[model samples]
Target: MQKLHKLLRMGDLAAFVGIVDDGGFAEAARRRGMSASTLSRSVTRLEEQLKVTLLRRTTRSIEITSEGAAVLAEAREILNRSETLKEIATSGQAPAGPLRVNAPVPFVLHVLAPRLAEFHANYPAIQLSIDMTDTLVDLIGSHADVAIRLGRLQDSEMLHRPIGRTAWKLVAAPDYLDRKGWPEALADLARLEQVRFAAPDHINTLRFIGMADPLEIPASVTANNGEAVRQLVLRGLGVARFSDFMIADDIRAGRLVELFSGQLDAEPLEISALYLTRVSGLRRLGVFLDWLDAIQVG
Candidate 1:
């Protein structure tokens, strides 16, 4: 029983599921980062231990036997229950694992960075690795422990906790507004020079509160970097739409002024802390989520 338990690691079960999911040894091997022969050997070893043929292989395809199908279902259930048990067991212990996290560049700099010292002081045993980028990462494939995401999520498999909210604001340097004059209505936006952020191609079609319908703003300048946009706005070049958190300090310091404060829609973007359901219940992740929720940033 001890030997049998030693052989049944999660990686082996994952490989088995991969093979069954991909419908062939080669595809499963690719997904699992192993060669087809290696995956076949592992499966063969597993079958030998159980004294049962799990797969019927042909030149063109491979199929799970009735027994194999039953085993697969049981394996999945066992893995789920095992993970749950591990989470519960570790919840009361000090967090002492490597945690890989991802978030947008602006959010990391403005919101998270300021609070890292406190988190580190509280949980010195946990190691943190953060990737700051605008691109969404595949949490499972990337092995990310956690991610901070804005807006609605299309993937339903991830467990999400709402952390906070931020409103999008049209902002410009006080000096720039002094020269160009503030626009009275949405129609005036077309006449003014604007800086736009790097967004999906379809974003241009969506209408903001002031606009009657979708209207494309003249991209007098376009930047993939959020910091560059903020700098340009600070230099009195043009008005840019930015999340409130990004320009909060500037607004407070009188470096930038909010445009159309009352007339704009003031849509609040929902910020969420997301992780795979499998990873969400881990001790380190749970603590971080609680910490994130406790933080109050403007």
Candidate 2:
């Protein structure tokens, strides 16, 4: 037991996890505000203690071996267990730690930004690192404790909790509609230029409630970010289909006009909070999820 204690250190395991999570010693050190050499030494010591070559380091990159992957999985479990132990020790105190979250830009701006103050007030000790990107990010690789995803989730090993749903709204700025005549019939969309979402799931065709055939629309501009597309539409550039949570304020304020409001037959996008199954019991995560559940963005 004494030999094992001498060989293994929790700090070393944490450094190893941090190195892999950030993809490089320099990056992990920079993110943690530590020296890269210190992180490199910790990884070396961990490798020596474990008696396996966990990582193959190159000048520009570090590649994880199969053994490294296995170790990383165990390391994450151990770290999460340690965090749980801490929470257990201080049952009455507020949970605290860094909580990294990955989410889309529009959701971050429209939905989360407003409620953040309240969340911070509730858990003031919690440090939040929010990565706002329209593209899908790997939860482990990005080092995100939680990820807010939209649409039908693909097959994943991570655990997910369905938060709510949001439907797409076809909208255009009043000035744009005035300049380009309002689309009366579905066929009129052919003449209109649209600001489209540049995602794999985004389709060029539209399906209406009563229509037998799907209508294909012309895409004049395509952006990966939802906010960018909304901005383009607001500037009288073209028509756009945005999620209801995003356009609710704009529609109410008459900044944008909703076209075919209740006539479209489309599946509502599923909003889910995804996380590693190991960290599901963590108090900090639970608090955030509870807050999310209360908001119910749909």
Q: Model 2: what TM-score?
A: 0.93
Computed on alpha carbons, the lDDT of every model, listed in order, comes to 0.76, 0.84
**Inter-residue clash pairs, candidate 2:** none
| Per-residue lDDT value at 220 in model 1 | 65
Per-residue lDDT of candidate 1, residues 1-298 (tens digit): 3244455766666667678877789887775678999888878877887778889999889989987887787666666566667767877778767687899888998899988999999999889999888877776544566888877778766788888888777778888767877767767766667776667443223256655766556666777778777888899878877778999989999999887775555457788888865545567777888899889654
Instruction: State residue 129's C-alpha deviation in candidate 1, in Å.
Output: 1.2
By lDDT, the best candidate is: 2
Off by over 4 Å in 2: 1-6, 201-203, 277-280
Query: Poorest 10 consecutive residues of model 2 by lDDT?
Result: 1-10
- Cα-based lDDT at residue 259, candidate 1: 77
Highest-TM-score candidate = 2
